[model samples]
Target: VVKERNLLEIIQKQFNLTDILINRRLKKRDINQCCQRLLDERQHFLNILTKCRLKIDKNYNLAQNGTISIPWDWSFASNETL
Candidate 1:
């Protein structure tokens, strides 16, 4: 009976150790995934900002060269008596 109890105890210890190792691996994997997702989001935001900056620069250049025209509306100023 004593030998049987010792064997059972050793098996239980090994089982507990394996469980802890698995949990540690899973936690590390979760952390890596979270970091990757954050990096992807940051990259996407930077891309959008770059596109907006390019568009604004193009419009600014066109306006500076007198390429864009704005039509004056008489009705807009009709509200105010000249």
Candidate 2:
């Protein structure tokens, strides 16, 4: 009877250990996925920002070279009325 009880206890302990290990592995996988998603979003945002910067630079160059005319007929001192 004593030997049977010991065997049962050992089996229970092994099952509990396996459950804990599986839970830890799942949690780790979730964390890794979250991190990768955040990284992808950050990279996408940076790409958009770079495109915006390039567009602004192009517009600035065009304006400086007089290729693009900005409407500036109104003067602060000679404004008819707002």
Candidate 3:
């Protein structure tokens, strides 16, 4: 699932995820778009977040990034760390 500013084009292309994220594609979104990622290692058991590098704004609370492993749900679930 992509966000407002998702850099999915480069990520999907580099990772060869066209079939996964974009089943069939030609005209792609700009690489500048950024997105957040969630790790569902164990369904309701666990989760983690990782935001696109390009989305790291100056006001972002990066200090809390990876500072703790919180519940993998809701708002915190969207806080990217990868």
Relative to the unseen true structure, what is the C-alpha lDDT of residue 30 in candidate 1, on a scale of 0 to 100? 42
Model 3: runs farther than 4 Å from truth? 1-6, 20-82
Summed over model 2, clashes come to 0
Residue lDDT tens for model 1, 1-82: 3543343233324323221111132334443443333234443334322222111111123235333211111122325431
Error of 3 at 40 (Å): 17
Instruction: Per model, state how many residue pairs clash.
Output: 0, 0, 11
Q: After superposition, how far is residue 18 of candidate 3 from its true place, in Å?
A: 2.9
Tens digits of per-residue lDDT for model 3 on 1-82?
A: 3542255443433433322232122223221222223222323322222231212222234234332222212243546543
The numbered model that scores best in lDDT is 3
Q: Which ranges in model 2 have alpha carbons more than 4 Å from their true place?
A: 1-26, 43-82
Evaluate model 1: give its TM-score.
0.21
Tell me model 2's lDDT, rounded to 2 decimals. 0.28
lDDT of 2 by residue, 1-82 (tens): 3543343233324323221111132334443443333234443334322222111111123335233211112122334322
Clashing pairs in 2: none
